[model samples]
Target: MHLSIFKWSYIVTAVSLVVAFLYGGPSALFLCVILGILEISLSFDNAVINATILQRMSDFWQKIFLTVGIVIAVFGMRLVLPLVIVWLAAGLNPIAAFDLAMNPPADGAAYFPDGRASYETLLTDAHPIIAAFGGMFLLMLFLSWVFEEREHTWLSALERPLAKAGKLDAMAVLVSMIVLLVVSETLAEDAETVLFSGVVGIVLYLAVNGLGTLFEAGQEDDETTADTAVDKALAGANGTDTTDNPTADPSAVQSKARSGGPTQLVRATGKAGFFLFLYLEVLDASFSFDGVIGAFAITSDPIIIALGLGLIGAMFVRSLTVFLVRKGTLAEYVYLEHGAHWAIGALAAILMVSIGVHVNEIITGLLGVAFIGAAFLSSVRRNKALRARGEDPATVGAASH
Candidate 1:
């Protein structure tokens, strides 16, 4: 792997550490470093999922992802999102929310000198809604992946059946609705709030993912038209009839020309690329919801949280994403995507479970890491087996679901 991809992340880490020390001395710097490590540990699966999507994007959009997308991930999700949550949940103005975050209670007190709830308390109060929305969105993502028929199956016993069942129409949606209903009725303290938030999440996922697919199809159609035109021109010069012959199967042409299989990726451009970018940002936001909330456990200072999670953690995640795509890691380790999605499913379940009972952040981080690590080991074993059989490892496990 090239170290140059991570050069900026290293620079940012160093500079941020210095700035943290200057801002609040040794303690602040230590907290920042700790928070950065926490973010990375909790989000390793996020980097894997991101690489899968990033590989499908065009070069220009990929650059935009590293540039423009990072700003949104850092400032938008890390800094502003907390303030907004506090504002809405506490019924305060944006300025008041900012003030509240800027001046947090000392030593992680639950309330201020004025007897008002502290920033951490207010944010914690808003956890149900956040978890509901983010959980449902991630659940939908996992369900869709599970439902799709893939060329490769990581856990054949489980995935093969799921893929077979996926033949049924709207299976993913039906299952998601059932899960939401069950959770809202039995598990959630705020049933009305959970139901509303979960429905919003499901709807938003459908809208964003549906629009992306539509735009991607349009892009493919345009390309197919261009290719057909060229084919006709060449046929004309050769004095051959290029009109629809008995051998011309449009479905076969489509299946062969487009990136439809599990392992293949078509670089999306124009409006398709924009929607894909949008989808990626939303996915990142969902993944970060837990991290943002969990950061309060380390420290109540919003500035420090942002500096650590945003600058240090987010940058490294992006760098890891670029590394995975450049090195064909996803293709090499076919089960990695499966593991990442499984981690996402677990996260969604944990988020829902947290609505009724508190869950330790450490448990959450460990579960994700365990899934990813298991997947990596499974991939290694598969490669070794293929080598022993005198087959090319690259010839198998071609695409993501």
Candidate 2:
């Protein structure tokens, strides 16, 4: 199973890196590759969601997602960001920003006309950056809570009246925009741009999801065909070919012998694989958000920024993904998803507060680490208790459905 998983991951990584490197230079290509891997790892749970929803998509659409979605993400988020950041960063002109991004002072000192590092100075820019990340993550928390509650049939009191309304994700995006607008008016430190950037972040998520949805449609159609075929095959008289040979490749005969285990395994694998991919990407983006702004405390070369952070970050994310999937770590950590949701929420809050309070990226990272770590510890304790009582985890109390 791990061998198969590794094979597939290799394919995904290889494909993503090739694309990234081809579009951008070594720096960009490396950045994309690193980010892709990072995103894929952190969002394994996201992959679970993706697989479930992707069942609705067409194969063509899925291809579009693999191809087009990556394009938008790499260029829109990474390449174009410097220019945009420069424009939004105070009175710094595009050239000045590019200059700051590309060429630092020869003396490793502040080189701007004001004797302060213009672009160099921005390496430590926390407010605008954190605001975007924290704001979006907070929005994620709100959406998760609202959606989770909407599904609770036994608790009418806990259910929202808005549950009867339109999509919660869409609503969250709108609300985020409004919040940005309000926060912008109050927080004069690049408030308008931060609001604008927040809108961009939301749009990027939606666009990625929209593409994912399209792929899901393709999958839905295939699933329908497969189901129809299975029904017809099952109903056919003396047609036992599909069920024969548990370990053998039954290509020559209509055998009757079959193992139920393999079928269950296939279903489980498919289900797990889908969600794992989605969760990895979502988490990847989350991690990147935490890293990007945080990178400001370092150098400002978009090239170096992408390279330094991307390489180390990407490797770590991939390793983590492999560990979780291969090691069946999710089975061990019941509250991982919960922690992710909370982390997303905390990051969003930190991003929002960054506008006024200048929340540090270290603080943001620590919050995520702390929330997830706490949830993990809680899950372990709860699981240990369940084991002591000999209760079935499947049937026992787990927060998630």
Runs in model 2 deviating more than 4 A are 1-84, 87-99, 106-117, 122-130, 141-146, 149-171, 189-191, 238-286, 298-307, 394-401
Could you tell me the TM-score of candidate 1?
Answer: 0.92
The 0-to-1 C-alpha lDDT of every candidate, in the order given, reads: 0.87, 0.52
After best superposition, candidate 1 residue 106: deviation in angstroms? Answer: 3.4
Q: Count clashing residue pairs in model 1.
A: 3
* Cα lDDT, model 2, residue 190: 74
TM-scores for all candidates: the values are 0.92, 0.62
Best candidate, lDDT-wise? 1
Question: Global CA lDDT of candidate 2, please?
Answer: 0.52
